[model samples]
Target: MTLVLVRKLLRDVRWGLFAVCLLLFVFSAFWVKIAQRVTTEIAPFFNGVAAVSKINPKLFDEVIFKGPGKVSQAVLGGAEIRFDRPDDFLSVELLHPVVVIVTALWAVSRSSGAVAGEIDRGTMELLLSQPIPRNRLILAHLIVDAVTIPALVLSIVAGTQLGLALIGPFEVDYSVLQKLDLPPMVRLPAGPPVLEVHAARQWYAVVNLAALVFALSGTTMLVSALGRNRWRAVAAAGLIVIGMFVANVIGQLWDSAAFVRPVTVFYYYQPQKIWLKENWTVDLGEAWAGGSPMVEIPVMPVLIGVGAIGYLLALRVFDRRDLPAPL
Candidate 1:
C-alpha cells in the first residue's frame, strides 16, 4: 500500500509546478535584498545617535528598532513606497500572499485528481478490483498529499534563501556579528542574518504556516472528493483560496468592519509580528512604527484547528463514496 501510494504521488509531482515555485523564490530573494539595503542604510544613522555616550560602531549596528522610517527615507527619501516599510528585514512579508497562492495551487493540483479524475479516466474500477480496501486507498491519497505539502514548502524556503545569498549584500560589521554571536562564516550581500527569528514571532509563524497549510490542503482534498470532475474540484479549491486572500485584504483595509475578518485565513497569518519583531528583534519602533493588532487575536488557533478537523471529515467522505461509472 505504501509503495502504491508513493508511486502514485511521484507520478503527479508536476515539473511545471516546481518551476513556478522556483521562479517565485527568485523574485522573493530580490525583494529581500532591496528591503535589507534600505534598512541597513538607515540603521546606521540611528546607531550613530545612540552611540553618543559610547562611540562604538557595533553599538549602533546592534540596536534594533520597530518601524520603517530609516529604510524608507534611504530608498524613497520621504516618498511612500506603498506597503514597503523601513523596518522590515525583507519586504517578503508584504508578498506573503504570493507564497500562499503558489502553495495553494500546488496543493489543489496534487489533490484534484485523487478521486474524481480517477473515476473519470476509468482507472477507478481497476483500483477497486485490487486487494486494497476503500478506506486504505483514501488514507494513502491523504498521506501522499500531506507529505507533498512540506516538500513544496522546503523548496520555496531553499529557493528564497539561495536567491538572497547570491544577490544581497555579503559583508556586515564584525562587531555587530560578535554582539549577536553570529559565526564569521555567515554572510549576506546587504542584509541582516538570513535565518532570524524572535522566540515569540518564530513560534507564531510556525503555528501560522502549519495552520494555513493544513487548512488549505484539507479544503482542497475535500473539494476533490466532492466535485464531479477534476476541473471542477480544482476550480472550487482555487476559488476558495483566492476568496480567503481577498477577504483578508478587505479586512485589513477596513479594520472596523467585522464581516471580512472572520472569513479570511490571512487574518491569522501575521508574518511581520512573527518574523520581524518576535524572531529577529529588528527594532519595530525605529524601523517600522505600526503595531499589528491582528497579533492579539485569540481566534487564530480555533480557525486552524477547525480546518484540520474539516480535512479529516473529508477523508471519511472520500472513503465511503462509490466511484462514478468508468469513462
Candidate 2:
C-alpha cells in the first residue's frame, strides 16, 4: 500500500519532472556553445602573449582571470572569482536562484496537492475511508519527496554534462600558448592538479543541490499539510520562497543586512563554494589586494537540521489536523 501510494505521487508530478528536465536540456544546449565561444576568443589574446615569452598558459590564465578587474575582480580588487574556471562555471549554472525557485515551485505544486489538492478534488474523503492511517499517508508523501526531488536536480546536472560533451573538451588554446608573451619568472605548474575534470571538482554540487531541494520540500510539505486548498498552499509556499530569496540576495550583496543570512535557507545553500571545495573570508591583510581570506564551514549539519525540523513540524501539524469535511 505504501509503495502504491508512492507510485501515485510519482504519477502526480510526472509532468513537473519532465518540465524541469526539458528546461535544463534547453539551457545546457545553449550554455555549452557560449562557453566554447568565449574560451576560443580569449585563447588568442593569451596566445599572442605566449609567443614572445616563456610564460605558461596556466600562469597567464590566473593573472587575467584572477587579476585585478579581470573576470570577477572589482576596481581595487576583491574576490578573485573566475567564472571561466570549470568549478565555478558548472556550480553557478544550475545552482542559480532561478533553478532553486523553479524546483521549489514544482515541489510546492506536488506537495500542495498532498492533502488540500485531494480535498479540492473530493478524493481525500474517499482515501481516508480506507484503513490507511493519516501518518502513513503523510509518510508516503515524504518518502516520495525523498525519491523525486533529487532525481529532478540530477537531471539538470546530467543534461549539462551531456551538452558539454557535444561541444568539446575545455582546454586552454595551444595557439595562445604558442604566441603568448609571458614573464620568464612565472613557474610552470608541476602537473595537472589531482582533480582536473570539472565534473570531479564540482561533485559536491550534487549533494548540495539535493539538500537544497529537500529543504524547499520540507517547507512545502508543511504548508500543504496546513492549507485549506492546493492553490492556497502554493501561494503560501511561493511567498515564502520569494521572501527568503530576497533576504538571501540582500544578505549576499549588502553587508548591512548580513544578519538576515542566518535566518534564510538560501544562506547556507552555497553550491559555488561547495563545488570549489573552500569558502573565502575577507583577506584582512589584502585590504588593498582585493582578495577574500579562505575559511571553511560544515555544510551538511545546518541544511539537514533545517529539513528535519520542517518535516517534523509538518508531521505534527498534519497528524493533529482534522480531515477535509466532505463537500
Candidate 3:
C-alpha cells in the first residue's frame, strides 16, 4: 500500500520534479559561468585593491572593507570572499538567493501538499477510506522525498561540472597574488595563472543542500499534518523559511542579533566554511558557547535532527488528530 502510494505520488509530481531539476541544472550552470565572468571582470579591481593594500592597509580596513565587508560576509555565508579563488567564487554561486529559494520552494510545495493538500482537494477522505494506514501515507511522501531531494541537489553539482567543463579553468591575475604579499615560502605559479574549479570541493556542500531541503520537507510536512488547508500550510512554511533566512543574515551582520544563529536552520547551511576552511562539523556545545566571531555550526546533524523530529511529530499528529470533512 505504501509502495503504491509512493508510486502514485511520484507519478503525480513527475513533471514538476523534472521541470525543477532541469531549471536548477540550467540555472546552476549559468550561475557558474556568470561567476566566472564576474571574477574575470573584477580581476583588475581586486588587483588594484591589493596594490593599494600594500600602500595603506588601514585605508581599506577602516574605509572600504570595514562597513561594506559585513554586507558581503552576510550574503556569502560570513567569510572574507576571495574572488580569485575558484572555491570561494564558486561557493558564492551555490549560496545565491535563486538557488536557495528554488530548492526551498520545491520542499515547501511538495511537503505542504502531502497532507493538507489532500484534504484541500477532497482526496483525504477517499485515501483514508482505503485499508492504508495514515502513517503509511506520510511514509510514502518521505520515500518520495528520499528519492527526489538528492536528484535535485545532484543536478546542481552536475550543472556546476558542466559549466566548469565548458568554461575551462579560471584564470587568476598574477599581479593580485604578488601584491597581496604572500609569505616567502608560498610559491607562485610559473606558468599561466590558471586554477581549476575542482568539483570535489563541493561534495559536502551538496550534502549540506540535501540536508537543507530534507529539513524543510519535514518542517512543512509537520505543518501540513497540523493544518487542513494546503495554501495556509505553504504560507506558514514559506514564512518560516524566510524568517530563518533573514535571521541568519541579520546574525551575520549584527553582533547583538548573533544569538539567533544557534536557532535558525540556515545557520547550519554553511557551504562557504565547508569549501574554504574544510570545516565539516561543529560541537553543539561550542556552537552554544558562542565565543568565535564565526564558528562552524554542525550542519548534517542539526538538519537531520530537525527533519527527523518534524517527521516523527507529524506522524504522531496525523495518527491522533481528527480529520475534517472534505471541503
Candidate 4:
C-alpha cells in the first residue's frame, strides 16, 4: 500500500519537481553574480576610509566591522590591529526574503491538491478499495509530500554552493584590488589570497528556507484535506501565503504598531539580523548585547507546531471523509 501510494505521487508530481529543481539551479547562479557585484562595489569604500585614517590597511581589508564606538587609548596603544571596517554582507541578507517568498509559493502550489483534488476526482475511492486502511493511506501521502520538501531545499543549497565556489575567488580578488590604496605603479607582492566565505550565514539561510517550506507545506496539506477541490485548495493556500507576506511587510514598515507584529509571520523570519554584517555585534555589558532584530523577534515555534498539528488533524478528517463520484 505504501509503495503504491509513493508510486502514484511520484507519477503525478515528478515533472513538477524537475521543473522546480531547474529553477533553483538558475537562482543559485544568479546569486553568485549578485555576490560578485556587491563585493566589487563595497570593498573599495572601506579601503578608502582605511587609507584616509592612515590605519594598517590589512586590518581594514580583512576584518568585518560590527559597529562604531570609541576605541580606548589603552586598547589602541597595545593593539596591533588598527581600524576594522564591517564587511558588507548585504548580498545574501538582501536576497533572503525573495528566496523565502519563492519557496513558500512553490510548496503551496505543489501540495494544494494532495488529497482533496484526488477525492474530488473520485480517485480516492479506487485507492481506498484496496486492502490499505484509510488512515494508512492518508499517512502514506503525507510522508511522500513531506519528503519532497527536503529534497527540493537541498537541491537549491547544493546548486548555490557550487555556483558560489566557482565565482567566489574572482570576487574576492576584485574586492582586494578595489580596496588597494597604492598607485597603479606600486604593486604589492601577490601571494595566494585568502577567501573568506560566511558559512554560518549560508547555513542560516538554508534553515530559514526549510522552516518556511515546512510551514507552507503543512498549511497547504491541511487546506487540501478540507477543501472541496483543487482550485479551492490552491486559492486558500495562495491567499494564506500572500496574506502572510503582506502582513510582514506592513509590520516592518510600521514597527511601532505593536499589534501588527503578532499577525506577521515575517516578524519571526529575521534574515537581516542573522545575515547582515552591521547587525552582528557584541555588547559586553548585557546578556544580549547586540541589538540584532533577530534577538528581539519571537521565534515561530508555535506556528510550526500548529502547522504540524493541523496536518495531523487534516489526515484524520481525510480518512473519515466520503469521496463523491466524478461528473
Best by TM-score: 3
Candidate 1 has its poorest 10 consecutive residues by lDDT at: 75-84
lDDT for 38 (candidate 4): 51
Better of 1 and 3 by TM-score: 3
lDDT for 81 (candidate 2)? 40
Which candidate number maximizes lDDT?
3
What clash pairs does model 3 have? Answer: none
Q: Mind giving the per-residue lDDT tens digits that candidate 4 earns over 127-197?
A: 77789877776576667757776777677667767876676653334345546577676544432344355
Candidate 1 C-alpha lDDT tens digits along 1-327: 656866766666756556755766675666556555544444533443434334654433234211443332322211222222333545344335566667667767766777767766778788878888776766776566566555655555555466556754433332442344334664422334332322233334445555566677677777877766888888888998888776655433444543555556655555555555453222222212343333334435655665666567777887777667764
Model 1, TM vs. native: 0.65
Candidate 4 Cα errors over 4 Å, as ranges: 42-98, 170-195, 256-258, 271-300
Per-residue alpha-carbon lDDT of model 3 for 90-192, expressed as tens digits? 8886788888989999999999999999999999999999999999998899899999999998899999889988977677545545565656765544333
lDDT of each residue in 225-313, candidate 2, tens digit only: 78778898889988987898777565544556656655667666666665675542222222222324433345566677777777887
How many clashes does each candidate structure show, in the order listed? 27, 14, 0, 2
Q: Is candidate 2 or candidate 4 better by TM-score?
A: 2
For candidate 1, the clash count comes to 27
TM-score comparison, 3 vs 4, better candidate: 3
Q: lDDT score of model 3?
A: 0.81
TM-score, cand. 3: 0.86
